[model samples]
Target: MGLLFSKFSSYLFPNIECRTLMLGLDGAGKTTILYKLKLNETVNTIPTIGFNVETVTFHKLTLTVWDVGGQERIRPLWKYYFPNTTTLVFVVDSSDIERFSDAKEELFSLLGEPELANAQLLVFANKQDMPNAKNPAELTEILDLGSIKNREWFICGTNAHTGQGLYEGLMWVKKQMKA
Candidate 1:
């Protein structure tokens, strides 16, 4: 049977699959980060109204990442994509300091979802290349990342424009997935 073959294939190949959800407020660079990870190049992106799914291989793990629309009207759709998600990658516009509270609220709300209760959290404090961008330490404070409990989580500073800190983030995700 199919189950036996799946188990055998997994044992022989050991290529694990991780379902990851990438989310953020509108204009937070979630699409940019997804493409950068998928293509290793920056591609022009408009607001994602529905979602973008891409499979990225990292350290023997195949990450099927879902980058959903973050606009207020579309945010409600995010929950429909939450089931079976193994990792939640949140991209934040660190330079847009005015929206830190909004980001924190949305992040905590998503974490509260029962479907994603087992999901590991990876927070990308993105736009770190901008002069006004907040650093990872500052973002950790503003987002109140320390208050997160019952889930493994990490925060990394990143610049999707030049592809900095993205792989480091993936490395952490990979470790968490393996654990």
Candidate 2:
């Protein structure tokens, strides 16, 4: 998937390289946001392996966003991309309170690394349109993002399947990088 980016890196996305890293487990809407940024036609969800990279040009900044696998078995690979990331976005399934702790732990461990000390963190409380989904404040209380330095974070309720909240999320990432 990223082969195209490598080919076009010279002419297309000329300046940026350290892209935003996005990680969450399966059914967390990572891929959906990927497609939304790509202006892709949303269809059946495809399972990601180690990860997938998508490139989008927002004005002069060409964002090479990496979507890491969120499934339990594939999580170890998440560390590989975390170090050089310009920003880290942790997407949470707001409806799943039972698994919130697991998500928090994974995110904490990732952000704890010295390499990521300066990275911006953005949390997407996704699937907000769902009937059972909880709000951003509830998710924020569970994640406790206040401690992190460069602590710019947003809790945007999103329905990735419909392309809502995707732009706001992307724009937030851009803002973090600029700041």
Candidate 3:
């Protein structure tokens, strides 16, 4: 009877919703990661001109991820969706050494905003499968993750093509949210 009651109770209550905002420069595998999590498979994607919202259920939580366009012109519009983001998932093309500064600039600018002050940061050092990709440790230094003081931040090495290290990143987000 106890087990039956517990199962019924779960159905009576709704899963907690977590709003995750995914951002990055073009070709950083943001869209690919989104689809991989949502469908459990890799999919070809073009540059996101606007944004895409998808609900992905992880364990008992429902994560609503917003994949926004990462082009220069669309970056200004990102602030508009900053109101209630629970976590900021920033994807970085770790192999693109030349764009590290550009990525850092955009990342810090968003973090400085008051609207995102309370949001937890999950930086995916994406494209880790590439030969010249920067590891998470190197990215932490290059992106200055150590200097962020307002909220908790983590950098994870991930290869979206094989779905490697993606779950670990989400697991971190879940743990933080639960805390």
Query: Which residue pairs does candidate 3 place in steric collision?
Result: none
Give per-residue CA lDDT, model 3, range 114-177, as digits (tens): 9999999999999999989999999999999999988999999998979898999998988888
* Candidate 1 lowest-lDDT run of ten: 170-179
Clashing pairs in 1: none
TM-score of each: 0.92, 0.83, 0.94
Ten-residue stretch with the least lDDT total in model 3:
9-18
Please report, in order, the local distance difference test score of every candidate based on alpha carbons.
Answer: 0.93, 0.78, 0.93
Stretches of model 1 off by over 4 angstroms after superposition: 1-13
- 1 against 2, candidate with superior TM-score: 1
User: lDDT per residue, candidate 1, 32-58, as tens digits?
Assistant: 999998999999999999999999997
Better of 2 and 3 by lDDT: 3
CA error at residue 53 for candidate 2, angstroms: 0.7
lDDT of 2 by residue, 23-133 (tens): 886778888887776774675668887777888776556778899889899897677886677777788988887888898898888877777777778788998988778
